[model samples]
Target: MKKLRNNTALLMMTLPGLLLLIAFHYLPIGGILIAFKDFSYSGGTFLKNFENSPWVGLKNFEFFINTPDAYIITRNTILYNLVFIVLGTAVAVALAIALKELRNQRSAKVYQTFILLPYFLSWIAVSYLFFGFLSADKGLINNLIMEPLGFHPIEWYSVKAYWPYILIFANLWKYAGYNCIVYLATITGIDPDYYEAASLDGATKWQQIRHITIPSISTVITLLVLLGIGRMFFADFGLFYQVPLNSGAVFEVTNVIDTYVFRALMNSGDIGMSAAASTFQAFVGFILVLLSNFIVRKIDKEKAIF
Candidate 1:
């Protein structure tokens, strides 16, 4: 009781954010019932309609799980996320380390700003930017480079074989800069005395970095990787949809669970199926976080997120 009174101001400071969390996250959880319902708007209010809807238990799940495209969508979602997690971590850490080595502060800030600029761009804008380089007749790649080099212009959008690489590259380009900023902040917080001590002991730059820098940031890296594991079943909808201009030819490589659900929702207007898909995603994501945390705890309890 005494401690609670003493920390009253700090607890009060957290009240607004707590309320927002309840409003946005906790309150809406009741809508998960829609997953099992043949949901429709009949009259009164959303909650009332939700309540009155007839239950069709698990029928909605069949729309996604029993479809022929199920395997493809699931495979693409998992594979793309695995690649993103591995490559994104490597590139972000490498760039952060390289940026830290820059001697000139002004140039470093300028470079950081330029690198992070793409992160702020909407996927629609990035799609147009990509179109400038990929347009068959007038694109810079085709007209300037391919023609000058005596190669034929490729139909970039129609080629499913190339989209896997293209999407991976685009994902990295948009996100790596922002990801590196986190690592760079972690690196900056590291003590300079460790490096000085290593240098006095005749350690090279590489040795000092390997021994000090990476170890110091390992916790942040583990935390980020665990978070990424939780979202392994979700893809960035815009990256798969808008970036490819929604090309049907590249759907084999680009279509993911989110995109598949969106297209299904658009065509059929099946609210129950869409809700079911979302519920499934949330359940799988929750399980994944728990499993990953369990493994991490077994390997190194200190690094486990829980």
Candidate 2:
């Protein structure tokens, strides 16, 4: 009787969070069924009547696979994310190491706050800021750097060749600081006695970091890498869409799964096809996460997400 009462009381305390999860996350998941339907507005409301919306199981998937844009968007999405995962983590780790060396708390905090500020900015806002620097005519790069050096002002938006570098650099610049803070927290949580003992053993700075610091943080690093791998099949909508300013000229390089789906749905109103793309993405992401978890467990049992 006491256990039953405690369970009910615990349920009551958690009811609000459970309700929020159902309201926001699980309830909307049913909308995923639209991927397999030839949706139309004939139904006054989509949820009220899924019966009138005929199901065409595999057609949408077929169409998206056959799409010419499929190769480009998928490649771009995967490649960009891979670069972000590697370069972003590298930058973060480096920054975390540097921050760990700082004994002064105030200076460290100031630098950290400044670095993390960029992560809070919206993609659209960052896009405009980047435009101010890269704009062909009056951009800071052209007006202040290239033109001053008697070079041509390259049309950044119209140019596809430069976007990969731009995107990777932008991703690092915006998110590295935030990610480094996580790494720094992990680093700080390590026992100072490890470093002190290393010093007693005549360990140099590099040796201390190499043997003690890197190995200590390996678990967190592995966890973050696993999470990155899980999301490998997805793309950031704003990074691909807003950062390049949605210039059609740059679509060859910048087009990604999210933007491609948005275009297909909004422009062509192919709800079925767009839903298929989304479903495909979600399915792949799910499988990848499991596969990733398995791989992580094999490499380091302690680091696995499971």
lDDT of 2 by residue, 118-210 (tens): 999999999999999998888999999998899988999998999999988889989999999889999999999999999999999999989
Per-candidate local distance difference test: 0.94, 0.89
Clashing pairs in 2: none
RMSD of 2: 2.5
Model 1 scores worst on lDDT over the 10 consecutive residues at: 41-50
Model 1 misplaced stretches (Cα beyond 4 Å): 1-20, 42-44
lDDT per residue, candidate 1, 137-159, as tens digits?
98999999999999999999999
